[model samples]
Target: MSRRRLPELTHHGDRLPAQEERERVDMLDGRVGVEERACRGLLDGRLGASVFLVRSPGVVDGRGELVACTPEACSRWVRAAAEYVIVVNDVSAELEAAHRRAASVPWWRYVAAQRAFRDWKTIARRYEEVTREAAEAYEPVAREIGRALAEMVEIAAQERARQQDETRRHRSVLAARAFWGWSEVTEAGRRAVYVFRHDVPRDDAPEGAAPEESPHVDLRGLRRAIVDLDLPDVRWDGAALAETERELAGIGFGRWWRDLFHEDFRTFTAPPPARGSSSGRSSPSGGTATGGTGGFSGGFSCGGGF
Candidate 1:
């Protein structure tokens, strides 16, 4: 929907400029009132510590109406734009760093990072953009955000599936490769030993600096890369993988759901529709699905599958 510019209010003899008025509007629009509650979920892991706001269901009304927004409306919109400034000294470098940190973390956390990144890119971004527009006096189109949350959960499920597949699938690793601080004497040493290492991509590494390859002194994998000086059938369980199918399936999205949605909302009442996907053997609908795939329960955790 288009932004609607609320008429600027005058104080004494001074008149606020149109741009300043827009700025004023931005701050008040979509802003949580001091009385309203808020909860934050820091993007877990190295996804670059980004922050977003999740709120309770009151500021927004039943007909998509917004209730008493702010009493200090005059100053709020003026500072709104200034409030949301994301500055990373280097974009690519930061993203790469976050990705590196993200590597080898819990499968569930990696999944959370994926979702958080997308949220930062989309939903969270949208909220900010909408606030900006609202400050400009443009009204956001109202829709059931509950459904949108469902879609996010669905994408999470898909990501989990992908991770599972990647774990069991074969990955290519160069043979006779130089491992950090040491060269693999695979041919001379034990053939059964599995080695793990962190290899940063050339492009991500600093200019002209040979990419650092940090090899784990501990054997983390078990494969026959036994041929010395030859590229034996080397592969990557690709590191950062879930140790077992049980761990993979054990991760739950319940907390994520509850955190994003309040207890009263139906979406928060049960595991996402794919309960079995993350919660092992349970159905996504939770309990017995006596009706069409519905979200309702006595008291369910949001740990659906984050």
Candidate 2:
């Protein structure tokens, strides 16, 4: 897909006189905020460190979304530009030293030194041109670049908030699916308890939630509800789970129903029994579908293939 473009930062108008353009550029420069100032300083080899490194800004994700950049990533960009400046300076110094020492050197040595100087001059000139071009490009649009970045950040924050809200609203539905997907029967004081994995906490979970209390919803009730619907023949197995998930999607539940194993929504009910258990049956291994494939089924069950 074609990457979405950011707002154009270049000016558009009748060409101004050189003096007027210089004045205009200076006025725009004055409008640069702290982050922009730091960025400019870094480009000019002024600041050793700045908040721009911490801010990290972000990049467009091709779909017009702003993806947050890591500090490490931001540092790489700064480092590349800084290294270019250092290279140019170092090469210029080496070339100057070579010229000064040429008169005292042997003929062959002077020839080799002159050849090396030519290469260094080209390298230094190229790096210097790049640095100058970068500064020139940034100077005119510094204010606009800063404004656009701030807007992008705000948009990203709002997008995150919207997503969090959507997740919060659908958490109950996710919990239900998670129970159906991962819950298993376990012994708890001679009673058959439905163990639902509840390890992953919500982003907006209550502060100081009961640490000892495990989150659960008795899915046995859901099983009973299915039976009460007079669908007693429905075997809640892997096939049934697959069909139910498909139906949920068909009815506008979207892709959320398929997120049973997603880390954010999944639970760890309990560990499975060893291959051979007291009942003399092997626990299901892998996701190979077994049992009779005849007739229709629905709901969930800890028995058979799943």
Best by TM-score: 2
Question: What lDDT does candidate 1 reach at residue 253?
Answer: 25
The TM-score of candidate 2 is 0.30
**lDDT: worst 10-residue window of model 1:** 1-10
TM-scores of all candidate predictions against the true structure: 0.16, 0.30
The residue-level lDDT of candidate 1 at 60 comes to 29
In model 2, what lDDT does residue 60 have? 16
For model 1, the superposed segments whose C-alpha errors exceed 4 Å read 1-143, 171-306
Candidate 2, residues 122-217, lDDT tens digits: the string is 644554565466555444344334455677689878999998787655554544553332222222222122212243322222223332353343
Give residue 90's error in model 2 in angstroms. 19
Residue 290 error for model 1, in Å? 56
RMSD of each: 29.3, 17.8
Residue 79 lDDT in candidate 1: 38
TM-score of 1: 0.16
Which digits, one per residue and each the tens of the lDDT, describe model 1 over residues 83-194? 3222221222243344344442454565665654543345334433443443333211111223333454587789999986774342112212333222332323222112
